[model samples]
Structures are given as C-alpha cells and as structure tokens.
Target: MNKFVYWVPAFIWIAVIYYSSSTPYEKQDIKPWLGDWVNLSWAGPYLERISFTYNNQEVSVAAQGIAGFIEFFIRKGAHIGVFFVLAFLIYFALFYTVQQNKNKPLLAASAWAGTVLYAVFDEWHQGLTPNRTPYAGDVLLDAFGGGLAVFVILSVHRKNGRKKKFNIE
Candidate 1:
C-alpha cells in the first residue's frame, strides 16, 4: 500500500472526528441532540430498546449476570453504556479507513491506537463543555469498547478473513 493511501484517510478521519464529535462534547446544547441530532439520543436508545425487545428475558438474565454489574458504576452525568457502544462503533467504522496492507501488526496497532486516542481526545473535548463533564469512567468505557472492537474484527468474521502470506523463498 502506498503511504499516501493510509495517511490521507487517517488524517481525514482525525479531522472529521475532531471537528464533529469533540465540539459537541464541548457544548452540548441539547437542541442538536434533542431537535436536530435527536437522532443521536433516539438511535442510541433505539438500539438498546430494540436489543432488549429482541432478547427480552434473555437480556434481563444476562444483564443480571454481567451487564447488570454496570449498575454499580452508573450515575447521573455519565452514561457508560452509551459511551462504550459509541467507542466500539467509532473504532469499528474506522476500520474501513485503510485498505488491507502487508504490515498486519502495524495496521492492527494503528486501528487500535487510533481508537484509544480518539477516546481520550473525546473525553478531553467533553471536559471543555459546560453541560457535559468528562468522566474517567466514560474514558474507561471507551477503552473497553475499543478493545472489544479488536476482538470483534478478528473473531467476528470466520470464513472471510483470509490470511496473507508473503513469498520469501
């Protein structure tokens, strides 16, 4: 892969994230989230509600076993679950930024590192906001999501992830 191929998209995503996501953290007017970006609130809640409807009792049971554990940490001003899922998606979606390259380790590390850094910056951006305050728990949740993405990319696809081999003879 050409250096420009990877770097360009990397920079573009960074810029897009920096401009779009962080600013919202800095000033959560809610009009956007409530009126224009209402989809933000709606989508997140919708995903959860739909997931619940689909799973029903199984979700409750699983939540009681493991997901319910999050209750111990959740509180006002911090939505850990939302942040986690958002991070997971951000990282996962970002995977499309680069085409497959020869350097497996580098590519994996870049994807993960970008995710982790994005989480940190997102929190910092939130810190600058008045209505929204940055929470360490959120950052941790973000990291957890990012970490999960790595596993997902590796494991979620079974028959599709072809191993690349280099001829060294």
Candidate 2:
C-alpha cells in the first residue's frame, strides 16, 4: 500500500493529460476565453503599455492578437511544465519501487525511459483521436521536459548525498 502511494499522483496526472488530449485541437478554446478576459476595459492601458516590433511594424495594435500569441506559447509551455512534474513523479515511483541498493543513475535513466515512452504513447493516442495528428517534434519536446526533470532530480539527490543516506546504490 505504501509503495502504491507513490504511483497514484503520476497516474492521475497522466489521466488529466489524456482527458485533455481527447478533445479535438480545433475545439480547444481556452485561448479565446483568455483573450476575452484580457480584453477588459480596465486592461486597456496596461496592454497599450506593451509593444513589440515584428517585421519592422509595431504589432501592438490589438490586444486580441497579442493574447492569441500568448495563448499559443502558454499551450506549448503547459506541455513542458506538466511533463516535468510527471517525470519527477515517475522518478520517485521508480526509485521507491525498485529493490533496495538501486543506483541513482539507473533510477534516473529508468524514469527518462518511462517518460519518453509515455510521450510516444500519448502522441499515438492523440493520433487516434479526430483531427489530431502525431508530431515527432512534440515528442521531442516532451522528452526534453522529462529529461530535464530527471537531470534536476538526479543532481539534487547526488548533491545531498542521498545515495548513501537512502541506500541507493
């Protein structure tokens, strides 16, 4: 029971990603809602204060345009952010589930493998959904997210000498 607890959070997060992905990409409207919210009268002056030059033209004419761009970045960033958390959870679960005397490197590698594999599976799942096509680039991004988390976790563990303290070989 104690060992199972470590996996619960990972499973829940994966389920969340799966549920969200089940929605058609065209139907994903978080961006429009966000654009409307940011277009409030009170936000006009604040939005006006920000400006950027794109193709030698000032591109701050409309708040909605900027909001749409922001939304695009937010969506991609969410992929990395959520996968980072998932990888960390997977690392903890793997670390605890393996027999005693496991090495930190091996545990980290296993976590990365699990995360990348999941990313592949997720993209495949998305492909089966309507109007969604799998992209190798997205898989690479997911792997980067997961790999970064594993690297950070491993560094912290090694810095703290956790291997010796926790009996991780």
Candidate 3:
C-alpha cells in the first residue's frame, strides 16, 4: 500500500477542524437544538447550585441557564474529543509511513507535538474569526486530549507485550 494512503484520514480530519474553527460561534450554538431535543428543566435547580468562573467568564446555570450551561460543557467536550481523535489519527499515519523500526515512543511524541501545534494554530485561527475568542485554556484542554491519546497508545503497546522502552532519546 502507498504510504500516503495512511495520511488521508489525518488530512481530512485537519480540514474538518479548520472548517469548524472558521465558523462563527452564533452558527455553532447548540442551546436551541438542545432545548428542542431534551428537557433539562428538571435539573435546573441542581445545575443552578453549580457556579464558577472560567476564562474570566461565569460558567453556571445561573449565568447561562440550563441549556447554555449544557452547551458549554458540550462544546468543551467537543474540543477534547476532536483533538483526541486527531492525535490518534496522526499517530496511525506516522506508524504506517515511518520506517518500521522507528521507535514507538518517538512516534507517539511526534503525534502529540503535531496535535499541540495544530491546536495552537486552530486557536489562532479562531482569534481571527468574528465572535470567536481564543482561550489558552482550550489549547491546554487540547494538549490534555493529545496526551491521553499517547497514553492509550503506549498502554496498548504494553498490553500487546511489546514492552519497548519508552525513552524518547
């Protein structure tokens, strides 16, 4: 198989991330959809008890109401999920395209590095888009997602009895 074939998914995923980042937040708001799909009013009292500040903004049912509160978490979770998948896809591409004997740790590191760099770029791109505020916290969340992917990959390799030293030197 052509090595380039291994990279198609990663490239496509990158495009998806780019397109999502390019959209204005108003178009991406999910509160109305959530309101249409589910009844969260029952939890409003409980949600109202939860209050905190994030990125200089209040995040709670009191600040955003039930639907907005739920949407906040959903959007943050999407950040983690999308980047998690991107990291794994990047690792998959690197595993197939690199020399067979290349160190797995190095490959994992490279995948994580790529994910972080892309997250930085994505945030920067979002900053340029109207109604989008780039938060460093989101980038940290993305890095955590990529790190989780690396951990899962390493754990899987260890479970498969590879026991390869994880040194990146």
Candidate 4:
C-alpha cells in the first residue's frame, strides 16, 4: 500500500470530528436518526436500565431525558472510537515508514503521542465553536481510547513475534 494511503482515513476521520464539534448544541443534540435507533421498542428496557451516579444521585437514561442521555454517550463514544482509529492508523503508517530494524516500541509511543496532541487540538477547536466548551475530561477520555488502541496493537504484535507475518488473505 502507498504510505500516503494510510494517512487519508486518519485525516478524514479527524475532519469528521472537527465538523461534529463545530455544530451548535441544539443542532447536534438528539439527531433524528440516533433518536430513532435508540428508541426501538426491543431496546427500550435495556436502555432504561443504563444509569450512572452523578452528584450523589443515580440517574437512569430515561430520568436524564432519554434522548439527551443517549446523545451524551454517543458523542463520548465517538470521541473514544475516532481516536482509537486514529492511533491504530498512525501506528501502522509509522510501522511501514520506519526501517525494519527500528524499535517497534518507539513507533507505538510516537503514535500515542501524536494521538494525544491531536486530542488536545480537537478540544481547542471545539472551544472556538459557539456553545461548545472544551473539557479536560474529554481529552483524558481520548487518551484512554488511544492508549487502548496502542495496547491492543502491541499485545498482538508481541504475541505473534517478530518473524511472523499477518496474512490477511
């Protein structure tokens, strides 16, 4: 694969994150499609069962305003998920670009560092948008997601050993 090809998806995903953050709260909240998906009758009871403690009170999804609560999780999940993909792609791109004898651990660390920096930039970008206040907590969440991606990649790479090739076909 061309080295540049690996970067395309990562850049595009980052663009998506930026676009999502740029939307005003009201415009982004409870997107009709998501609202429909989460409200399916078959999943209603399970969704209601999901809850978390905030301010010393247990808040169920329904109690929190069903659509709003679900939207919060969806947005946070997107943060985690997009960063995960970004880190993974960065690692693979670096792996291919660097010399074969270069230390793999360093490449993994670099990928994570890049992901962290991107998360910070992402938060800053959000701060520039009206009705959006960047939170440090979201950066931490992004780091956790990137870290998980690096851990999974390193673990599998280690398990397979250096000599083995992963044949997708």
Best by lDDT: 3
Candidates in order have lDDT scores of 0.48, 0.79, 0.93, 0.80
106 in model 4: Cα distance from truth in Å?
A: 1.2
TM-score for each candidate, following the candidate numbering: 0.44, 0.76, 0.93, 0.76
Per-residue lDDT of candidate 1, residues 1-169 (tens digit): 4445535544565565555444643353333334343233333443344224221233332343222322223322233443344444444444555456634445445566766777688778866755555666566666666566556555544324443233222
lDDT digits (tens) for residues 68-133 of candidate 3? 999999999999999999999999999989986778899999999999999999999999999998
Q: Is candidate 3 or candidate 4 better by lDDT?
A: 3
Point out where model 2 deviates above 4 Å. 39-64, 162-169
Off by over 4 Å in 1: 21-106, 156-158, 161-169
lDDT of residue 117 for candidate 3: 100
lDDT of 4: 0.80
Q: Quick one: ranking by TM-score, best first?
A: 3, 4, 2, 1
Off by over 4 Å in 4: 31-63, 162-169
Model 3 clashing residue pairs (backbone): none
RMSD of each candidate relative to the true structure? 10.6, 5.7, 4.2, 4.0
- Which wins on lDDT, candidate 1 or candidate 3? 3
Worst 10 residues of 3 by lDDT: 160-169
Rank candidates by lDDT, best first. 3, 4, 2, 1
